[model samples]
Target: MSSSSPSLARAPHHDGSVTYLGPVPTRPGGSVRLRVHVPAPGASRVRVRWGQDGEPRLRDLTPTPAFDGQWWTGELPLVNARTSYRFLIEGPDGARHRWLTAEGVSEREVSDRSDFVLDASDAAPDWVADQVAYQIFPDRFARSAAAADRELPDWAVPQAWDEPVVAAGGPVARQLYGGDLDGIAEHLDHLVDLGVTTLYLTPVFEGRSNHRYDAVSFDRVDPVLGGDDAYRRLIDAAHARGLRVLGDLTTNHTGSGHEWFRAAAADPTGVEAGFYLFDDQGYHCWLGHPSLPTLDYRGRELRERMYGRADSVVARWVDAGLDGWRIDVANMTGRQGGVDLTREVARGVREAMTRVNADTWLLAEHFFDASADLVGDGWHGVMDYAGASMPLWWWLAAPGARPHATVPLPIDPLPARDVVATMREVHARYPWAAVTASTVHLDSHDTARFRTLAGGGEHGGVDDGSSDSGLARARHLLGAGLQLTLPGVPALFAGDELGLTATTGEHARTPIPWDARETWDAATLDAYRELVALRREHPALRRGGLRWLSAGVDHLTFVREHPAGRVLVHAVRPRPDGAAPRDGEVRLPAAVLGGDAADAVTLRGEGLVRLDDGDEPVLALPGSVGAHLWLLPGDDLAWT
Candidate 1:
């Protein structure tokens, strides 16, 4: 906080608050409570204009006589089509409108594209919204002695357990450090200690490549990784420890070595030939990569083999006790050139999962804007790179942190205000369920490690590392605070909690150095543990309503209101100038305390605030490098 002095509150009404839009996650044929808050408690009349892309219908709102409040409401039913809505309020002055978009309030007309979007066809597993995910790359995590005792495949280049990994697509990609299912099973305790509820593994099916996107088969777990039985054992063990394991699946394509592909190549007229986009010119492969032949959904036979049937590959794994499937390259699946059936394929998978386990999650991996597919229809959630991580990089990482970031390449530093707005835009497109269930991460196997970006190392085309180790470490902790405090199923890329540093993602994938505890950043790990515990312990923090309570040039503060309680997260960035930043003050929203800043704050002698009823708590800041968290009682939370 810059100062402890109280400041007048900004009017918080009609700005993405439930007070303005109630009973969120609007569904088809269901009524939603649309309310608008104003400076004054009551208005003469309020109208809601809702419709499809080009047409809109209006309904007059009647004030609820029950418990009179500032929020004027209209209850209306949504139809079968995609819904878009805005409010028209009638106050003493005249008629004015309120456009509630992901970008917050706008009086002028916003394109139907920007209107609040609701896809009732889309709904994620309710359980995922409140859980955190822990990502593990099976090839480089930890190798149990049992896995180490196995023979190496001819295609794999064996290396010592502690050796650094080489990054390349051919033989280098084929190298193995021997981490396997048993190793993850052995480490369930560590994940549990970190308060993780989900164990998300990279590809583990029969495959030769270290990343395993090039799978030879879908039904069997690679024997080198302890095969099918090991997968079951891992699943059973993970379940015993109250953790769920989701395996990776590549529906976009299959390796050249896959039996169907090999057979199809030899006999174009064979039963499997239709699986590939084969023609007189040749077959189509993902990104024109010859080894990864794109699967053709035109072939019902292929769709049935993959996800359509109860006996399909998807069902086999779900029945094998795996909790879910993480669709690899989901952006490319069922999409080639202008042709697309991505939703059909995805919906097929969702139906298959429903057959096996109604609670099973279905996540898609897309570095770009996945809103086209994430509209709540098929995918339970997404590895939400576009929505969260990339925007963060644009703000926190160096301008040149590209080729290293997954999408929306970081070419320049984004203003703090722009970052918050972009996040709101991405978040507003989905229903509350998908928004909360989306997976948010700092770095993963597909990109350079986040710490590397913080270190600003230029190793391998990456131009990051603009700060010294000490300051970089603090920023990383702040990143953790933001990731955990913001929405999404917060995920850790295996070694991130240990303050792992790397030049590139490949280096970041270095085998977990179990023997190098003396060299680890213990403080970073402890902070991560605390943040995860914070998420685990509070239901509100896990799944809550978010409001940007305060934002400034060098500082940001937000409140997450949940049913269990409300929590505040504040983070700061180093000043660009080579001078100390002045102290900052963050004024909590009056709506949060159910009164104005000067009004005696509610929840006195309750929640995390220790002040008496008359004292309003204000955040006082010290320096630039800081992150703070506080929990407050939610039941007493009200916007008066």
Candidate 2:
């Protein structure tokens, strides 16, 4: 008497209509109701059935004179959890369809997948709030000295760090720096020193190329980057150092070399035929990319194999002590209007992870306009690019250079305000429960380096360029400050602390030059380190409600306050000649200030001030630089 195997019962019907009901609950004799929605209204008879797996029972449900074309409800006796049932819809001319017994089951169609159900009790771990994530692109980070000792595999070629990656095309320009997990493990101390509490490794699953986005196997780690044992040891070491590890999970597509794709491509009618969408026009590729083939969740066996059944591939990884999953291309999972396959996958992943660790998080990578599908009941969080990085570029680079306007591009300062407004609006529309905890980042392996985007080497300023490195660093710091102070979890790309600039693709994913003191801008690094320390010290900066105080042509100010007595004020000055008054002031509703006429504040600007008597303490800005202020009641010299 399992839940999946339920008893079936049939009932008498007239006007060519019949309704079949469940294998009643086996626990007890509680009352249950059967509800149905009829689209077309007509003179019809309804039949209801209920029973256990072995024994079947039948009953007739007569249509009342006041019957409408909408919903119909009936009460019946319930048993226990060991019951499964379905409804048989009978239309005119012997047309029939079967419907499963579930709360949110779809009547129009029946699929092998189920929707995700979320509970507040199933919230992600509390420690996740304090985590500072650093994403690593394994192939470009660092090369392992141990790789030379190991036997070379057939699928991969041993390339030196200086060698360019070889593909079918002549001499691929993007160089392979040979960065691996062992390399990352060797440099854990560097990350720890930079205040990183979580490390998100790009797909380490066995694959052919440097970027492992096109996964070939979900069960084994890539041998070239040190296989399963290497990953296990890396996770162990990371955990020992108080760092959480999240592995990237690619579900939307697989490599052309994957077993399922190969099998399906060889034979159209094979067992793996439904695993991917394939026809004469090559395999069904995403965005016309032949190397990566999209997965099809329509097949019952495929769904069960990939995401439906417990102890599946996804569950097995969670059981292996992996902290969480970062889903790739989440928006394309269930595009066809059947049952949302993405939700189903999320549910299965969550259920399996919950079995191992209830607080496990599920983060999705959705490119654009995925708020509706991702927020309500789909994923725990998403890779937040729109709310952070996009706004940052718009604010920093869009002001001076119109990269998208003319032939050479003209910088438009008008869009800068719109970008900030949009970010604030998006955050407001999708509050903390939906959007706040999202991972906010500036640059990753996919995009150009932040410095390069800010105008690289055109004029002489910072790093022999007219881009003004100091101003760029200030804007970058301002962006980081905004991200850390906002509701979402702030993520920093490696080497961003030292103001690393990129000239090309390889430069964007290059290793952190820890030994290159000459390349590092000490002042910029200090600013970032101070910001990180400030965020770590203040609980309000990590998880708080953001209230926009004011926004102008050259100045932006905001306040972040938590439920506790912590409050932080952030103000940015974008123009050198613009002397905008810092009119916005944060005042607590409750009087935390005593009768002491003097007030002491720690401001980010030069010099210290002690106010004797005033309604509000004012700090003057030094030139065009930005400032952060912390107000305390009494005289305390301890500055964070």
Question: Top model by lDDT, which number?
Answer: 1
Q: Model 2: residues >4 Å from true position, as ranges? A: 1-121, 150-174, 336-340, 398-411, 414-417, 456-468, 503-507, 514-517, 576-600, 606-623, 631-640
Best by TM-score: 1
Cα lDDT over the full model 1:
0.70
Model 2 agreement with the true structure over 301-401: per-residue lDDT tens digits: 77676655675666777777788888888777654435467776666666666766776777788645445655333577777776666666666652554
Worst 10 residues of 1 by lDDT: 600-609
Candidate 1 lDDT for residue 634: 61
- Model 2 lDDT at residue 320: 76
What are the lDDT figures for the candidates, one per model?
0.70, 0.56
Q: Locate the minimum summed-lDDT window of 10 residues in model 2.
A: 1-10
